[model samples]
Structures are given as C-alpha cells and as structure tokens.
Target: MKQLIFSLSFCLLAMSSLFAQGIQFESGSWADVKAKAKAQNKPIFVDAYAVWCGPCKWMSANSFTDASVGELYNSGFISYKFDMEKGEGPAFAQQQSIRAYPTLLFFSPDGELLKKAEGARDAEGLISLAKPYLKANNNANQEQTTTDNNWESLNAKAWEYYETKSNRSDLSKALKWANTSIEMNRNWYNLDTKAHLLAKLDRNKEALELAVDAILAAQDAGELAEAEETMELLRKLRNN
Candidate 1:
C-alpha cells in the first residue's frame, strides 16, 4: 500500500508540472516574474498593449490562439501580457522604450533584453521573429546578420533619383534599388515602392504587374488596407 501511494503521488506531481509548463498569459507584478524566470531558466515574453488599439485586440484574439504559437510559446517562453495604460504595466512599458501599442519584448532569464518587436504580427510572423532569439548562444553578431534589412531606406533612395533625374536618365538605377529592396523584404511597402518606380519610368504595364503582386500578397497576409490601396492604384494605372 505504501508503494502504490508513492507512485500515485509522483504521477500527480508530474502532471501538475506539465500543466504549469503550458503556454499561459499571466498578469501580475514584475517582481513576480523575477523569481519564476530564475527558477525556470527561460526567457520572458512581454506583450505591451493598450486597451484602445484594435490591432492589439485582434492579435490577442487571433494570433495568440494559434496552435503552433501556443506550442512554441509554452515550451520556449515565460509569457506576460501587460496593458500599457494601467498598473505597473505602464511603467514597465516606458522602461522598455515601448512607444507603440502591441509591442512584444523578449528578455533572457537573467533579465537582459533579447529583442523587441512592435505592431501586429500574425502567428507565422511572430513565430519567425521569435525563433532566432531562443538560441542557446544568443549573441549580438549572430543577431546582426539575421536581422531584416531596412527596405524603406533603399526605396527612399531610389525614389529620390527617380524624382530628380531628367529624361529618364537614372531609371535603371532606380529599378535596381527597388528590385534590391524587394529581394531583401518582399513586403507590401517594398512592392509598392517598386511599382511606383516602374510607373515613373513610364513602364505602366510592368508597374501594373508588380502592383497586382503586391496587392495579392498583402491580401493574403490579412493587410486589407494595404491590399485595397495597392489594387486601386493598379487599376487606375492600368486604365491610363
């Protein structure tokens, strides 16, 4: 009878530990996090959010519920959800330089900041962003090489040449820069930049093609505003 009782007790303890290990959003004092993180040797993921942001709500409702996200987060992180306008949450947000709602900050077990991301990211995007930071040796050199390039900078430079050059003289340089931006990050903004440059060079047909691609990609990513705007611009350009 003593042996059987010990086995049952051990099983219950194991089950309890497994349950505690699952992905859960905790709301509490930052002090509470310090001990838990030390005990688990896991990083903390802080969601700095505000009540008034629609995208923040959408991320909480849709992105946070994703199965893969839940699995990865459960196993890999200690998660906290903070309301940026209330409680100690606001103070923490300010300390972390969180100027935007729905900012996500990742910190190492020792409380060193690993990465910070702002804006609404879907499940896949969030997973992609989190994977690199969870590495065993999360060094700055490894991070610098993996970080996404600033496509906007390249696009802005290309646009400057397109606007100033006479007789379409620098169109080739504009096209090259725009293409490089797209290759670096194939997001709606970069695609639109490429389309605009093509249109300026009087390559209306090519512009229309790139615009359509951008519209479809944005729509598929659930960026309705960008998709609609790009589609409308493409229609108008094709008509003219």
Candidate 2:
C-alpha cells in the first residue's frame, strides 16, 4: 500500500510536469514583446483571442498545442497570446480592426504588419502561415530572390480585377489570376477570395464546393469562427 501511494504521487508529478513543459504564456506588455523581437531579430506572432470565443478555445486545445507549430513558433517568433477583452491588447485589437476572435497577427521585429489572419489556425496551418514570413526574413539577409514576388503582385492584381469586374464574362481573368495566387501562396484568405469570385461569377455550384473546402480547411487549421462563417455561406449559396 505504501509503495502504491508513492507510485501514484510520482505519476501525478510527472503528468503535471508534462503539461507544464508545453507552451507557456509569456506575461508582459506589448512593448516587452517588441523588445524581445528586436533583440532576437524575430517576428512577433500575436494570437488575439477572447475567453468567450469557442474557436479560440479550440485553437488553444488543438492547434496551439501541436508539436510542429510549437517547434516553428518557438524557433522563429516571439509568440504572444493576447486576451482580446482583458488587457491593453483589447485596445490594440480595436486599432487593428479585429472584428473577430482568434485572430492571428504576424509582425516583423521592426513592428510592421506582415500578415493578419482572422481565424483559428491548427498546428499545420499555423506553421504554413508563418513559413512565408520566416522565409522572407531569412531571404532578406541573402541575395535578392524574386520567387514570391510574381505571385504577390499577381494576387494584388487579381484583387483589383475582382473589385472592378461586374459581369461573368469579365470575371474569367480575375478567376484565373486568383487561381494562380492560390497555387503560389495557398493561404486561406486567397482561397476564400477565390471562392468569393467564383460565387460572384454565378458559378454557385463550384463556389459552394470551394466554400466547403475552405470551411474544412479552416476547421482543420483551428479557425473555428472562419469555418462556421464559411459553412454558413456555403449553405446560403446552396439554398439560393
């Protein structure tokens, strides 16, 4: 009986330590994050989340705890998870025009906004999302490379074409450009835009299919709110 009790105590301590070994919330002001990023010359990954947000909880449970995400983030970023309703972070959220919870904002060490993805991101998706930024930073120190530039410029042009196109016939070019963007970046936002353009072109069937794909992708990535929204949009498109 004494040995059994000792073993149980040891198990409990081991379990506690295991949990503690996972990602830890860094406590400090945004300035602290900035200072750390500057000192380390790393990007800052800010997870803007709220307590009441279901997707935020999912992200914490699934995506943020994923080992791949942990390795990538721990290596390249000064990651900070912010409670969007609890501190000065809330004010920053408003300034950043965050309309939803579980928004992931990536910033350069110099404090430039590199990307703002509004959704829950699973481990794989989070790692994928952060990769471009990390690559960009690393490439900055090397000889100039133009691999991503064409895709970046093409994506911008596609958005412009989308904004101006009003007819299905006019949308073909935009669709083509957006598809090219997806092939290059494979970002959720790019895919979402592609779906939007497809819907606008009266390709409701294809649009709904793409929307469903996007929904699943977002869900898998731990972007709960985005998944829900995309699902709702899919339903509405189908109904129409």
Candidate 3:
C-alpha cells in the first residue's frame, strides 16, 4: 500500500513537471518564495490548498497545467503551493485566516496581501483573477492604485454611479455593489441603499421592511432630513 501511494505521488509529480514549462513554481520555503519575489520585483501567487480536497486536487491536475495559465503566471509572478493542513503551512494559514480548503492569495513582493479568492477555478477563471492585479501592476498611469474593499467607499461609489449612469447594466452593477456594502455594514445609509436597490428589483417584501426600519431609526436619531428621505423611499417602495 505504501509503495502504491509512493508510485501515485511520483506519477503526479512527473505529470506536474511535464506542465512545468507552463506555470513554474518555486521550490523552497514560503519565506524563501516571498524573498525571491521581492528580489525579482514581482508579485506572489499562492495556492493555499489541502491534499484531500477534491477541488484542490482537480485544480492541481488540470488548471495549473494549462499552458496559457503557466505562461502568464511564470512570466510575471513567483508562484508557490502550500498544504494548509500540514507543517509550516498551518502557521501561515492562521496568519492569513485561511478557513477554506482552496484559497488563492495574491500578494505584493513586499508581502502585502493584494487580493484573495475562494474555491476552485478553471484556467480561464484563474486567468481572470490575475487581470486586475496585473492591471494594478502595469498601469501606473491609471488613477486607482488598488482595489477597493471597504463597503462604505463602495456604497458611496455605487450611489454616485447610480445617480449619474442611465445604462441598465451600470444600474445593476451599482445595485450589486451597494448590496456588498449593505452586507458589510447595515448602517442606515447602507440599509437605505439596499432598500432602494431591492425596490428597483421589485423585491417589495425585502425592500419594504428595510426602508421602514431605516426611516424609524433616522427618526429616533433626530435625523429629520434622513428620516424624511427614508420616508420618501418607503413611499416609493410601497408604490412599487
């Protein structure tokens, strides 16, 4: 049984090597990989995975070996794989708050975490993940320096966009982005935005209660203008 396990492991390794010319991975400690990334002036791409995870295994077997994925990753980044359940992986996993089987983390060479995504991704999906990070790296001439994670900022951006953009797709994106902010914090403004978005969708049952709640909360806080605006929203929601 041990021999069979060894043979299987060897085969997997050999197969991975055949795809090695694609997304070549670093062969050293995690810290070493980070140092190499810094030295090379490149970002870090880590595949935080568990051995027994089926999706992790599938990704290793399939997506990691895709030539296009390899070309993009190998050209621009230092890649590393770690089994989060074992050895030094556990310590890093805890620091990174990795609660899932397969978490992909992208980091700056200076070791700042830039982005993260959960679950399995196909080659195309994985490639997509690299795009924003790549853009941030390549487009120094662009306005935004980093991706926005704060819900308040996102909520406000959504509001500004929604107010100015008449495109149906843009409206949907604004509403969706506001929904993310609402999920992050249910402050009055967040709830109000969510209520408005939900009302736009004709999601009356969901929108009505939140709009009313925001109105009452504003009234309690002596925020008369806010309460009045919320009441106006409640009227619109009811009319919907």
**Model 1 C-alpha lDDT per residue in residues 1-240, reported as the tens digit of each score:** 999999999998975565444447765687778568647767788888899999999998888877678777877778888888888876787688889878988876656566788899998988897787566323322433443457777777666766686433245445656787888878777787778777876778989999988887788788958566577778889789
Lowest summed lDDT over 10 consecutive residues: which window, candidate 3? 138-147
For lDDT, the strongest prediction is 3
Report every candidate's CA lDDT. Answer: 0.74, 0.74, 0.77
Clashing pairs in 1: none
- Backbone clashes in model 2, listed as residue pairs: 120-222, 120-223, 121-221, 122-221
TM-score for candidate 3, residues paired by index: 0.51
Candidate 2: stretches off by over 4 Å: 1-24, 143-240
Best-to-worst order by lDDT is 3, 2, 1
lDDT of 3 by residue, 98-120 (tens): 99979999986656677778999
Off by over 4 Å in 1: 1-22, 137-240
Task: Kindly give the number of clashing pairs for every candidate.
Answer: 0, 4, 2
